[model samples]
Target: MEASSNFLKRSGFLTLLMIFVLCCSKEVNIPEPVQAYEPHTSKIREILFIGNSFTSFNLGISYHLNLYLANDSLSYKPLIQEAAFSGYSLAVHLTNEQTLAKLNERSWDVIILQENTDIAVNDTMATLESIKAFQELVGNKGTLIYLLMSWPYKDQPEMLIPIIKTFEEGSQAIGATIIPVGEVWTAINQDGNPNIDLYNADGMHPSLQGTFLAASMCYSHIYNQNPSENPYLAGLENTTALYLKQKAN
Candidate 1:
């Protein structure tokens, strides 16, 4: 009987030990499987900006474009250069020696043409002719040509209508893509009196916010992605940047 009792105690102790071991195993923290590290496949694209002060102001649209590309996780690394002259029209660029030189400098993957706001609105035919000429310069090199539709003067809100019409007409005529930046500006302005002004003091050129918004639109159109996803603020307040992105989208 004593031997039987000893066996029972031993069995109980072993069972307790097994239960304790199982309980400890359940409490043990197992690490999750590590994901494989995948490197970004880097691609460099040469982009040329041919426009006026609207494209060059606030350190140029290309500058902000590069910033967005650099900050984003995308594989594209932009080699951006601009031939921007203040208050110059696309017609003037067609004749300018520097502009001609830049066109021949290299084969650009993309060329963005931003016409002077006044010229685009007032001389629509002239703007269309210049766009055609620029396209000819780009040649059949498979270079994607895009028109950067600029915004109207802050006080002269009526300019937006003609500007949009001109750009849309030019895009159809020249087979170039329209960035529709002016439309985005108009939408934001009409939505409400936004906290961030889209115009500079001259009520013509873009403010920093305006430039950022333009850049966001460019990035969205070119990359075929949502600009709101990009984290680069371009020195604007977070909320302002977000507003511009959402509006651009």
Candidate 2:
């Protein structure tokens, strides 16, 4: 009887071990997630946003960007907080030691800059010249430059055409990408948002909804992800679609 009991106990232990081994042996393959953009080969070092009132839309675009990125994170890019101010001249930004200190202290992976609205629109050679100087000063080590294109002035929408063209040229000169936030807004604003204001009360800055839209557009490109994949895009798409429909009506 003792021998029989020992045999049974040993057999039970062997069965358990076999089961555990089997569980560990075969691996289940999880579908590699498809990113809207290819897996980021490089991590984003830092993102510096420089613009006048439009870029500074203060807790507007930046806030909404964080909200979307924080909640629905499906990208491989590192978190890069924005550093900028409203009505900031390119020359002033270049001369500002504090601003330079931030870049010098940390290696920025990307810089999305926007010249002041007037400077960008007024055909000011100085603005572009300052940008050239600033670019050189930053020592273009491993940074990607980009221009943030803002929306048309509600009162003078035509004034934006030249500016947009010029910005494209400037971006070409600097080897930077362009985030056409203004065009995105124009597409969305065709529909009347009865109570929801798209631009700020001043009609120059972006309203809450406007900021969210800008954030969504920029985030989509920067992270190489599509907004359709983004959860927030649903709302934005719905709003834009409705706007288009209303235009048809």
Candidate 3:
């Protein structure tokens, strides 16, 4: 009888021990969501920017883009043009004569497309239709098109979801690459490292810091180089620039 009792207790202890080991193993091997990336060595030169105030605001993305490339030691530089309109949506740009005229006027190596912030979030169909229209307009051209995903409003953080989705859908539909600037902004805010203000007082336009971050990511994506390696600060402190560069990746 004593032997039987001892055997039962030993079995119970072994079972508990096995459960503990299994739990620990699972904890140690927790799985995380996989991220898909496309790393390329393509060099972009002779670019054009088209969109609303996001592309045309405060020296605009093109201005800092040149600064970033010019500062890089790798010797890649491009003539950048800004053909952005204030408060314009992709839908509006689709019909705008100036945008079309610019496309027809020059042989561009790449065209950076940015949609209005609210339109991208609230009206995805418009975004998609506009992208389709642009693709059709630029048909058969060797110029590469890149979607510059705009960020959400400062107060409306959830606005990011649809904006990102629209950009992703548009890029996939047109077979273009996305600069993912909006996604990077979301990440920067979530990571909270240095916690820099990416917006101007209006909470819509990008401040200098915001433009620097966007420019850094654009430079990194277009040149296929690590943003952290670039020495341009856009007059920002080294620490701030380093943090933005790391977040761009």
Index of the highest-TM-score prediction: 1
Evaluated against the true structure, the overall lDDT of model 3 is: 0.83
TM-score each candidate.
Answer: 0.84, 0.70, 0.79
Candidate 2 structure quality by residue, lDDT tens digits, 70-146: 54553554555555666787777887777777667666777777777777778657767876775786655777777
Q: What is the lDDT of candidate 1?
A: 0.87
- RMSD in angstroms between candidate 1 and the native structure over all alpha carbons: 3.5
Superior candidate under TM-score, 2 versus 3 = 3
Clashes of each: 0, 1, 0
TM-score for candidate 1, residues paired by index: 0.84
Model 1 error, position 237 (Å): 1.6
State the C-alpha lDDT per candidate: 0.87, 0.65, 0.83
Off by over 4 Å in 1: 1-44, 73-77
Q: Give the TM-score of candidate 2.
A: 0.70
Q: Output the worst ten-in-a-row residue range by lDDT, candidate 1.
A: 35-44
